[model samples]
Target chain A: MKKALSVIMVVVVMFLASFTVVRSASAEEVKITGVITKIEMAADKKSAIAVLKDNKSGESVTITITDDLTLDKFKDHRIVDGDEIRTKFEKEGDKNISKMFKKTAGC
Target chain B: MSGKIITIMLGCALLTTTVQAKEHPGKEQILKDGYQGPKTCEVCHPGKAKEFLGTVHWKHASKADHVDNLNHKEEHGMKNRIYTMCNGNDIVNNLKEIPPNAAGKTKFSGCNTCHPGDHTIDVGSTGPEAEQSIDCLICHSTKYDFRKRKIVKDDKGNVVMTQDRSTEAAANIGRPSIKNCMVCHEAAGGGALVKRGFSMTKEADVHVSKGIICVDCHQAKNHKIPTGRDPNNWASDGIYMTCVGECHSEKPHKDAGINKHTAKIACQTCHIPRTGGAFSKDFTKWEKMSNGFYEPSTLKREVNETAPVYAWYNLTVSNTPHFIGPKGSRTDGKSKIYPFKLFQGKAYYNKKDGQLLSMDFAPPMATGDTLAGVASAAKILGIKDYEPVPGWQTIYFGSNHQVAPKGKALGCANCHSVNGVLNLKELGYSAKEVEKLTTPEIYFEKLLKLQQENE
Candidate 1:
């Protein structure tokens, strides 16, 4: 009976810890503007990554995009290499995630 | 005390320069570590200076002159280059009017690249002393080591004039050596395979191995490299020109029968047969670096090699045989048969408008942002809707540079056999012609053996 009770308590504590991780991973948005140097699809098929180089600084950063609703649409115009783009993304834990991408190239 | 000392010091410096140039007259100057301006060398070599300035190299400073006698494709190439530097309306319009090359006008007279002038300075406007303009050591000095700095101008800073030669430049000036020519010629148009399909820098270039230098055949006159096409192509006529006739009799072949083909074929056709021994590679994806340079996305150089395509050439005017155009092209009864190299590359172009989108698409040889280049091109062309039609493009250019020894020339099977590099049918040969070309020759002895067996 004691072992069974300890098991239940441990399960409850594990469930509580997962919520704590979610709560602490407060999603914050960051906007970056640069040229899309390259785009790569995820090997596990869950997301895509776009590498952008800051034109002014020559520095680069990669953003992981997982929004299923926007993935195909995002690729149509904004994801092509050399497209000068402005993107709004969020960082939850370690991943730089993208929510919006705009190709601001002149028509 | 201060003014007088400054004046005296300046006088001594001028005296030192004059003494140094006089000491090495007809040789390279011993500058700080760079070439002294061409003016300094002309003090000793006025004739050479006058001659070199007349060459096409100096005229490139003006875009119009570059395409003056070139074919349609070359004119297109110049349009592409201007697209790279044009950003605004005034600039585009100004560039569209290909102006006359006021030799002493542009900031960097094309001559500055090889002659030793500060590319950063607008010597045309700055009116810097003539002594500050020309550096003759670059082409004449065997030990000359000079690199031109990029034209750098920032929003906040006023443009800076390119400084003079390195104070520590060692000097050994003399007539141009092969090494001196290679400094610029090797990288002409960009890399080893640019401009012409091959370069003299390669060890495989037969003439380079034969102890031949650029001047051997070029034989400069008023700095104009003679084309064997000159009406007065007299080899012994004080013009250091060379043609196959120089070494070969009317028939260069050991077998006179084989030499008959010379009338319809260029010597390079059989001799070169291949390049990089016939191979090349180009990685497709590349990224633009922060400093406005392009690099392969995967950080690897692409390698792709293929067989050469053949063509007809007439040397007097154009290197490319305008008559035939391509390997599969038929001669329009204008050009004689010539050997050529067909180089291929992948890039984007606007299919709708038959123009090469120089700014928007990465050229086959470019490593920078293709889209950015295209966009800029679109801006200049004033196109509202621009899209890319990505594909590989090929050009038939001269194959005269990289030559193999006679022994390595292609055997008959390389072209005449069924399994050959070229498809005669594609080249517009009839079925009968193809069959006849593919048939193996039977010597008289072999024919006699077959007759005996039948008997």
Candidate 2:
């Protein structure tokens, strides 16, 4: 009975450990500051995808912004092309999914 | 009192002082320079003078024909509307008749309140100075100063504006600058902001900082600036202006939706965005009195957006500069979407029938009495039972100039959101008619989400 209980405890501990690994993978892994190059809205006009030129590498990365965030920004602060923005995002396969959006102080 | 003109004066004064400090040759050298007149200009550049004489600038100063322009009023039957402007003794000898209060108290004039006898190149002359001919330096001078000194009373109460053509003539002659054009054009309706709407304020010239000038797109050939405008909102197939598409070959946006949207919108519609920031300096409010005219009530330097004001436009209106208004619609193959300002006027209706007449003519600042101008217009148009409709002359004006840079352009929500700037019903679109228009691929991700949720 004790042997069986130890195995069950081990299995429970592994399941909890897997959740942390998954959370770590999805947490903000990339930090980049760049000027916005372009923004395109979905056909439903619900969300938008923005392309930003990475200030350090001169490479461009795409970030997905949800519609709620877009509406919030549109109502008050507008993020336009040529505006410098710093974003922390998670790498979701081939895509860079935005976790936070902040308009930075540079060009 | 002269709202837009004051702004023009203020703007020009600042700009002139800056350019002058850097470029002014010196008072002594200017006095020595021999810029006798247009005849002097004609000596070497006769071709230019001949071409210029045929243009509107030459005719803008001449008398009688100026009054005769109001002959349309007589043709329409309002003879009382025929009045003179600037016939003061302070004016030149050739005016043919003196004014009601010649060179005395402030008097009534036609459009000549600000369009007075050639403040541009006449130097200070109250009449056509130099030869009874055109002034070349006003347009051709690189360092032209068009500041007309106020005709103030001397110790002896005399009125004078130097009448010194030599001072302006001797400045420096070259291609005209944006400064030369904006001197008058900037203050069209006595203020920058309806009889004077649809203007490019000094703050709103997008290309000026980039070294672009007026004549670049509004190129002159034979002294005629071919603005390619067509009044009465005709098809835009043949008429052309360089504001967009022509000057910029490709569609400006990266998205296809915006590109497709351009078919029904003008570039200024998006570029100009909203009005009445630094671009608009005054709010003109006229109250309709029992006398069948509008009288000035609340006038303030409020740059906030005035809800309903259309631009006076095209060659059809004498006061406006040359411009092409939006001329096409989606039904027409020639439609290129253009944006416009929605202008409001005091409506005129029949007192008996209570039917609407026209609010075609709104008296500008120079017209002294707003009600009198409206009465004259009503009478001229043969509306005997006409009455003023308070606060209901909503009209549309095509947006021009005042183009904002890309960074400052309107956001998509300005026109695309649930409660956007435009009304879908007014535009002939039902809610369902404008539903999602994407291809099947747009639903691919959403479908996956649905599947995941079901799991």
Candidate 3:
């Protein structure tokens, strides 16, 4: 019984250390400004994939937006093709998940 | 009572200025250290400096994919291209010196006066040194005095123009507004209301009356402002700003009959019936000089409130230096009827190779030797030989701004009549189609009869 308790304590510490590493990895956020070249809404209308052409580098970046506000904008056509947008996103696995998706404010 | 009120007003103004200064603590350090140029700003906003360096404004060149005559592999822009405004002169060279005979405020400074660089000589250089050459205050500071820019000798003894570097302007910084953009745009093609003919008065544009601004439509990302296929400046990535999907619905008109025209007619066609501001340059005829060079004749026509000529544009722009216009036809499926301000001028072209000669008529306009100018231009372009001849040309400036109110748009009778503004034959329509388009009375009568029968 004493041996089993010691093993359980070791497992709990390992699990907490792994959780801390994951938290640190997800903390890095990137911001970009670009024009939306294309948008693909999910069949369920809960998420979307937006391809933006970076204003400076002229490189294309794909970001997934699952926020309710941005999803409603896509449905109403307020944020459509050719509209310039400024966004903040974080890398999760192989995909970029949008943290903040908004049109580039002007004037 | 008046004396007390004056004191109170002064106190309030000072307090407001102090509060504004406190809001931007980073700028306060600039005031403390004095204006040390772009390097100071780069310390805090390094990302902005890097991003701005890659912009078209900094490089003065980009890929001209929107140009119909250009191959996709080549890169071109305002710096390298010979355009209508100063066609015969070398633009890169002209950035250094304002010709002795330059007109108006340009006499004091060269093209570099409007450029957002510390010195004319450092306009297109790269790396950390080039990053330091950017004059951030000119666009960002409201207090930056435009009059302070003057022609001065650089450390290398090169004649270059420089701008104000006062700590006051450095302390006050913000995003660019319409006022900042107008300082240069209003002065294009020499002086106010000369080139584009855009006016910011409420009467000029309904959008302005409703508190809209230039940047609202010309949205920018990392300083890359998307543009229409203006031959003077083409989009590198073929990205263009559109009104249909952006600010308005694809079909905005309430009437189906009117909405049907949206397929082939652009909004500017009926919306902007007239363009050009007060004293806009309409035509410039260059006459042959005794010295074998051509100079602009005194007989120039300036028009105001001019009617725009209609044309079919399909997003592709002509790259020809002599005559840059939109390339499209009524038969093309993507073509749409658009409005254009046709500016007529005269210049010399090569009779042998059919190349337009860059007329060297900058300073000493009286002795503009066409042959010498041609040789200089040819050397820069790597051309071997040419036979120069005088010729006429026209540049089409798209009518995209100074939009009128919805009610002020063109009426049906404006273009659907025998003596209307639109010329059906010139628009590349079939003879039968022309007759049908010009005779709208028949359609009106048929509609009236149908309505009477229903009643």
Candidate 4:
């Protein structure tokens, strides 16, 4: 009986430890990269749109920004019709993910 | 001796009489006859007389009785005063004689100098031509020499003044000159004293400098003058929007292009309200449709809600005296940090829940007050109750901070895509079918291209 109880205790401890490790690993941040494909300006010239793409997947997405971002950010980024890009994403919640560019280069 | 003396006297008398008749042929006669008036000549030149009456010159100094025919009321200090007549007697009395007004104040000298036409006829007076009612020979025939003050026949067999005739000289000598209209209508304050409600400013002389003539837009017919003021006073029986006139037809917008269809919409429909005059910020009446239609749903309600309250360390301060909940930090509290407990409504530590809550209620800080104070004061004021629910507490500090739905904040992947490409399907675009039109990718490209070209 004592031997069996010890084994069960060890298994339960490992299960909880593994659960913590899994949760922490899942919370790791991600990075993403792509070429700019579009831009939109607000009527008041305050906000603007910048659409970027994942070169590998050919997937495109749009992002809004204040006047902070400039045209130089996308210059010489090797962005074209079918260039490849890598991105990293961090899950914000069940429905949203915050992404940032890891690196961008010619494919 | 008697025969010789009588013969000499008869010859001298005949010579003197002939010279006197030539020098002042009809000066006294004309002054006494008071210009046979335009009516008598109208019998011979009916069409010309009719056209002359329609000109702005004829309406310059009409009788007050004739001017008052329109439904215009003087604004500011000029109460009950009509603008169409000059403030003199000869013209006013002449106008009165034809129209007959009980409250006739006889004064018409100024305006009459230009509007030289007779709407009425005295039985003994000659018609329009005899009264010099802008006779056709004056303009078409170019017969009257304005400088020489004598009749001259033109090459076309018509009577007219030479082109070199000064407008002032013509007007002073009883002829139509363009300067007559400028004397008042120009920015120099000769035209009608523009009162309130008109879009023009006191210093605006755009109408004059643009070479827009009074007669170009204000056509006259019969004895009636068509003014921008009212249709009843207009010579033509048609509806005309003030914006439809020639010079200002498509102004303000160089390319947007305004037309009759657009003018039908009130000027204020698209233009944000301005203050002062009809275009001023205080002018709200223009929001009404020109056709007298009202849509309650589209009307923007004036923001009159009470300002929000603020609480710190269990002490509350509000614009209104009513307290809605526990106060913030009191004046004597040491920390000045009040423990906020949201009751009645659910409070969430996560921003998503708070955003959801904000969508239904007032924004957390839109009232320019702290949310804790507002919630507490609302409870005290019986506006709402503060009931604490099971949730984590998130502290936010900022002026005018807006809490948006969780998935829709600025830095989300769905918002800022990798390479400026937009996934329309992620932005609730599919439900609205916005994807079928131009996708965000196309829209952004077009905008960039247009911006480059414009630059």
lDDT of 3 by residue, B1-455 (tens): 13443454455445434544554567668877887887778778776776777776666667777676676686565456555554532253354433333223222333445667665435456777667777777777767765555557777867665666788778877656556676666645544555667766556776656555566666778777776655455534335787764446677776678788889898988987877732222113445432232344422122337888888888778766467788889888988989888776566677887766664333324333445655656666677778767666677888887788877788676788888888878889888987888777745775577579989
Question: What is the clash count of model 1?
Answer: 32
What TM-score against the true chain A does chain A of each candidate get?
0.61, 0.69, 0.74, 0.39
Residue B120, candidate 2: C-alpha displacement in angstroms: 15
Candidate 4 chain B — worst ten consecutive residues by lDDT sum? B277-286
Separate DockQ for every predicted complex: 0.03, 0.01, 0.01, 0.01
TM agreement with the true structure for every prediction:
0.53, 0.49, 0.67, 0.23
Per-model chain B TM-scores are 0.62, 0.58, 0.80, 0.26
* Model 2 bad stretches (over 4 Å): A1-107, B1-33, B58-104, B107-109, B113-131, B142-164, B194-203, B228-240, B245-247, B254-257, B277-329, B347-392, B437-455
How does candidate 2 score on lDDT? 0.45
Q: For this target, which candidate reaches the highest lDDT against the unseen true structure?
A: 3
- On a 0 to 1 DockQ scale, where is model 2? 0.01
Query: Pairing residues by index, what is the TM-score of model 4?
Result: 0.23
| Clash pairs detected, candidate 3 | B88-B359
Best by DockQ: 1
lDDT rank order: 3, 1, 2, 4
In order, what lDDT does every prediction score?
0.47, 0.45, 0.66, 0.29
lDDT of 4 by residue, B1-455 (tens): 13443454455445434442342333344344433333433444466564554333443322222122233231111111111111111222221111112232211112222222323322113444424534332332112332332223456544332222222222222222233332223211111221111212112222322333344344444534454322112122222334334323344332343323143222222221111111011110112221121101111111111111122322222111111232222234331221121111122121322211111011111121224423433343344424322232121110111112222222212222433223334322453554343445534654476579989
Question: For model 1, what is the alpha-carbon lDDT of residue B279?
Answer: 23
